[model samples]
Target: MPRFAANLSMLYNEHGFLDRFAAAARDGFKAVEFLFPYAFAPAELAARLQDNGLRQVLFNAPPGDWDGGERGIACIPGREAEFRDGFLRALEYAQALDCPRIHVMAGLAPVGRRREELKATYMENLGWAARQAAKAGRSVLLEPINTRDMPGFFLNFQEEAHRIVEDIGAKNLLVQMDLYHCQIMEGDLAARIRKYLPTGRVGHFQIAGVPGRFEPDVGEVNYAYLFGVIDEAAAQCGWDGWIGCEYKPRRGAVPYGTGEGLGWLRSPVLPGV
Candidate 1:
């Protein structure tokens, strides 16, 4: 069975950020992930994890000026220094928290700048980041976000991300295959999963209902079937990675809504659960 990680950033908004860790553990989740952890001290976050018996599976590197709408600075020219500093900070947290992977968001593509220039910057930064992460025994992940949710995002397709991973030639560099984004940008989810999972380049997976970012069971996508596909494919390749429950609850922020939305996790769709 595939391991599932609660995405605390979205799943338990009804609780205080720190309190969400206990909420997730109460709901039988063994692992958790979030967008950013820079707001809290690493020691405090680690304590929460230790207390709840939860593992910190993933989190993002600092996205430049998230309030200013700069998703990431790694792709922008002249921000290499800032990007490196942010990644190092992220690595420090990763070490303190004992997390293994960090996702680096590819910033939105600017209209006036050449695509080639942005891509060159992205590759160079990733290459450097990968080398640094490798020394720390952690992996760096690149995810392809759909344009609808994040318009003009530099990375959008699975093939493109895998290609970049291959070109960068970093063993510690891997793709974060988010099924929601993949379904939005490309329809053949099973084919993509089969093709990519076996290559050992996929480090993580995420899911949500399509047409709406709600629980997986609410969408048109057949997550049960896809889950089975993930199991079969992963077993063949020995790819054991957590699938992050990265979706909004259908019940909004009401108490226990996130836990209630977890009925899908108890169903027969996920064998051996």
Candidate 2:
């Protein structure tokens, strides 16, 4: 069976951010991931993780002016200094939190900007970030988000992300494959998983229902079959990574709706249930 991590940003919304840790732990998740941790002190977040016995599997680096709609600055020319500073700050948080991976969002491609220019900047920044992360015994992740949900996201395909990782030749730089986005942009989920898992380029995964972005079970994608594929591929590739439950609760934030919607986790399709 695959280990699961609750995305506190989307799940457990019934409670405050801090309180969501305990709620996730109470519902049987041993690991967790969130969008960002800059809002709270590192020490405070660390205490929450320790108290709940949950591992911090992942979190994203600072995307420039999040409230003002900048998805990231890594690919935006002239923001190199800002991107480096933000990444270093994220690294400090990752080290303090004992988190192994930090996702570096490829900024939205600027309108009218040359693709080659943006690509050059993105690869350069990723290479630098990967080198920095290597020194700390940590890995940097790049996720290909669907343009539908995040219009203008710079990275939008698995092959494109893998190509960046390959071109950079940084072992510490890897891809974060979100199945939800994969289904949106491409349909061969199983084939893609089998193809990438053993290549050792994929470092993490996120899942949600199609159309609604709800719990995995509610989606048109057959998570049960996909989970089985993951188990087989993992056995062959020796990949033991966490699958982040990054989805909204269909039942809404009605106290235990998130927990209640976790029937898929308890199904016989997954082992150790």
Each prediction's total of clashing residue pairs, residues at least 3 apart in sequence or on different chains, is 0, 0
Tens-place lDDT digits, model 2, residues 1-273: 789999999998888999999999998999999999999999999999999999999999999999999898899999999999999999999998999999999989999999999999999999999999999989999999998999999999999999889999999999999999999998899999999999999999999999789989886988888888898999998999999999999875664568889989977374321
Q: Estimate each model's TM-score.
A: 0.98, 0.97
- Report every candidate's CA lDDT: 0.94, 0.93
**Predicted model with the maximum lDDT:** 1
lDDT of candidate 1 vs native?
0.94
Q: Model 1: per-residue lDDT, tens digit, 191-213?
A: 99999999999999999999798
Q: Could you tell me which 10 consecutive residues in candidate 1 have the lowest summed lDDT?
A: 264-273
Residue runs of model 2 more than 4 Å from their true location after superposition: 270-273
